[model samples]
Target: MDVEILARIQFAFTIAFHYIYPPLSIGLGLIMVFMEGMYIKTGNKQYEILTRFWLKIFAITFGIGVATGIIMEFEFGTNWAVYSRYVGDIFGSALAAEGLFAFGLESAFLGILLFGWNRVSPKVHFISTIGVFLGSMFSAVWIVVANSWQQTPAGYHIVGEGFNARAEVTDFWAMVFNPSSVDRIIHVWQGAFLAGAFLVLSVHAYYLLKERYVEISKKAFKIALGIATVISLTQLLSGHSSAEVVAENQPAKLAAMEGHYEESGSADLYLFGWVNDETQEVTGLKIPGGLSFMIDQDFEAPVTGLNAFPKEDRPGQVNAVFQFYHIMISIGMFLIGLTLYASYLWWKGRLFEKKWLLKIFAFSVLLPQIANQVGWFAAEMGRQPWIVYGHLRTNEGFSQEVSSNQILFSLILFLVVYAILFLLFIYSVNKKIKHGPYDEAKNPDEFLKYVS
Candidate 1:
């Protein structure tokens, strides 16, 4: 009802909507690079066709990612002026690096990747594909570094006083390589890869079911499956490593994540549970002391719980944090199981023969997206009451002059615009999938027209 709630909702809505596209772009970029590289390696026309088909999809995602992202920059100044000013010195450098090192490289090679297909040599074009992929990855690095720094503030010192106080970087590299940055970055990259790989698998699985582009779809599906399998396993490791980081640096957040209430007690890993904060109880299945073993290799090790922290400093939405975190973990484990089963079926030489498995693959694309979204929701919400860890309270960060009515109006406007953009994206991608990959053997002139 007030500016704080309205402003948080507005920014969260805008950022969450914007978040959907970047992972897709980053993930899709990796897939495109692999597809184009395969084309070059074998001089296979089918690989080229696959590369070209996905390139169109990649372009759509990249364009929308850029457009939706611009709004968040403006929102920083308009809705969170104090927060922006506080972190300006830190974010300014990171964003500048992204523009200089990441966006520039991706944008430069994009022309060669899209329009210079026939004009450039095959090797040169493949290089361009790698360039674009690396660029997207580097962009992710800077963004993650900036955000991770907020979660675990480092290399910064306070300046000024009260409302005038701000953080200025004391050590640039220390800030860049903040305690949580590397773990978070790796986790983010794996999530993005899963998002992209599942999308490719889903689309190709559909084509196979329809008996359209059967041979090409088989190749694409196999490649995506392999990627998905490897990333799913590594993602599990990354998640564990990230949890360790949280256990050490953000005990309150970790406490909230598992609904642990005792001041110094062994924490149980919940397979699934409902946290009733009123009575400080959790109901549902759990591995007793599993969390303690995971954190310290001891079943009875005492993990600092929410009771150890001041009530005002603890996360208010404990149930939401616990639920979001468990949902992410559940989806992650399911993906690992799904990809491994699909891999086993492929090894048995009956991958495509199982129509039921193919049907699951066709719909599995939503899982990774859901996991990425909820994983973020848990992380952000768990860090509640603080905009910059222990440094600044969230309530103290918003623009003082902004009104609830103004934020509400803009939020409504954003919802309308984003809905339209989402529709446009779905329609465009659907049309491309229906048309299928272009067949150079069947229509030589059409291929020529495409390259020209």
Candidate 2:
């Protein structure tokens, strides 16, 4: 395989693995905030116990997320030196802000959040939880800003020439608020929320089924379900808004996403389809002119397609992009339906009675994770040959000094290490879930010592 292909795959694999935890951390952080807040508000020890239980899970995820994330920064310099240098001025500022404002705040409050239960007041501990959650959110903000800039370059100017050329920030805020940044950030946040909420729902659903922590599980499930319900619906809106941004700024990508090949045509929205790249044909169910209506609110409105761009300039893996994009969309729709149905069941007082639904909820945790992963795959792959939109080609961005053999060797090593890390994560989380929340009622003295 070519060095570019190997490098891309290596980076993609690392990022995908690293991505698993941040959403969990962010989502779980919100869950903790609510749990702790309820404990304080109502003097409910169950909420306190729930908060503490999830705090341990949150710590596990945060630790793994941080550990896995570091490698990607190193990879940028090692495998994508040119790309790094080109966007360094922009990325450097964004990353620095993330460290100073996001990671620093999160880490600083983290110790209090984890260990201050006995040492500090409940209110203070609650504040630390909020800080950590906000920190994670702000972290997502800057990172998404940086990535969105690549998708829609802004607030920068070219400097030097040839290999020496790079982008320098002209308007820092403009770069921060790049056209696609806000929409993409919102999309990412909602996705992270779903990941966290579904995990809670899954765990509690399992507990309910097992008749362990029944009351607490019911409370936790309802709380998570509310969040999942609201966020899933909002996600649809965000997804549509983000797609509109894509349509406006990256028509070729939008076209590829739907397997549209005409130079200019009303594109159909496929429910699910197989794209034949060679013949420029798609086979499967589709709503006629659905994409056209989505973009222009007119069924006859023409949207630019892959043929509108030069062959080399458009995405190479059209079918893959379409598949990933559709998968994400399909999952989003499913989540919306699931959450709504569960919410209705709760309202009807039949939520816990349905063992089958509980079983479904138990396994549904994977849906959001899958959606988050493939959504990123679609977005990044749709960008294709370009590492920085129209400004830089991915082929031109990678380190010339790196060899395919070196990338392959490192990639294999990463697979082994990450596999072990993943297994450890599952083991740790599974153990915690099985042990369940601490019974504060049974340990009144310890609970009093902390609260008092």
Candidate 3:
């Protein structure tokens, strides 16, 4: 339509496409650390095989992740120059830290971890594995810190006047540990863990179904399942904590998330609902006063509603916000059940024999990706009209110099290029998985392997 909408769509498309790889890379990085560590600890050649196999997959994800990510950074200046200028001081520091501390560190050790498998000492390689994992995680930490600061707007003040004003950091540490950062980071990492584990589980489960690489698949499946079980529970706690923070810091967003329109003594948590904004009512199931209990641990406790906010200041996407939030939560609950059920089967020593469950796990790989995306959509959309939350409205964020035609042209190019990249990524990964890991045993004398 117009330049702003075109700009928003282009950014949204690029970012959404770019998001798939980072969580996959981050999740896959954690799995690599565990698989490599196990190889070092148990002196098992199978663990070594697993590590090498997944390392190749991780490399693919990391390379594409880095490539696709660069576009978004440039888009900031090209499409949203005003927003870039406004948050330049604060945002620049976060990006600089990410480049220096996260990307630099990860790249340094990634070479050792990926290429030094046959060349370096086992202990050194193990250390490299740990380093890569930490570096990837640190990358996520800084990025989330920057985004969370946008959500909560802490540790900063505006300078100058009107359109020329910019945010300046008052306290570096406060900027890093802003009110929502810790909770958001925890939620993000746990979600990333799920994404990675489910992927491993999906592939291994397929191998079991086809009766290929039986032993290797069994071990990998077990490891992934264990990770999935623990993190599924952790997400419940983390999601609760994150929501409470939203309630405290962003009452209007919380209100929109729950489809609560009236200012009242207590709010109900809708398990599934459709919000008809014009009528100011929600239709579907809800737990009476559940929102109050969730936030304050009291059924009668007051919870703020959209009515409390001025009409001009309210989130414009109330229905979308409610649906995304509920969908994310619903998928989360299903994951908890799936993991618990799988754990029960593992405890009974028959997890591998359950082909039906294996089939489900094979498809469930899409769940974490879905949850991560929708959860993000809820958070961002609920903060609607505000690119920098309380400080800057999104309408004021665009590059006034950019025209609709220019954005449309760039958007078309981005879609075409991203489509080609997506297809190539899929093909490369499928080829790797189909080829699988080599079945060679490592010679102890040749490798100097030891159990620690």
* Top-scoring candidate (lDDT): 2
lDDT of each: 0.92, 0.93, 0.89
Writing each residue's lDDT as its tens digit, candidate 1 over 120-225 gives 9989998999999999999999999999999999998999887889999999999999999999999999999999999999999898888877888888898999
TM-score of each: 0.97, 0.97, 0.96
Candidate number that wins on lDDT, 2 or 3: 2
Q: Write the per-residue lDDT of candidate 3 for residues 1-452, one digit (tens) a residue.
A: 99889998998889889889889888888887788788889988778888888988888998999999999999999999889989898889998999999989888998998889889999999899888888989999998999999889888888988779899999888999998999999999999999999999999888889887788888889888899999999999999999999998889999999998888669998999999999999999999999999888999899989998888788998999999999999999999999999999899998888899999999999999999999999998899888988889888999999999999999999989999999999999888888666523345453333211
Worst 10 residues of 3 by lDDT: 443-452
Q: Candidate 2: how many backbone clashes?
A: 0
Question: What TM-score, to 2 decimals, does candidate 2 have?
Answer: 0.97
Per-residue C-alpha lDDT of model 2 across residues 223-326, encoded as one tens digit per residue: 89999999999999999999999999998899999999999988898999999999999999999999999999999889999998999999999999999999
Rank the models by lDDT, top first.
2, 1, 3
| True-structure lDDT of candidate 3 | 0.89
RMSD in order of candidates: 2.5, 2.5, 3.1
The residue-level lDDT of candidate 1 at 288 comes to 95
Model 2: weakest 10-residue lDDT segment is 443-452
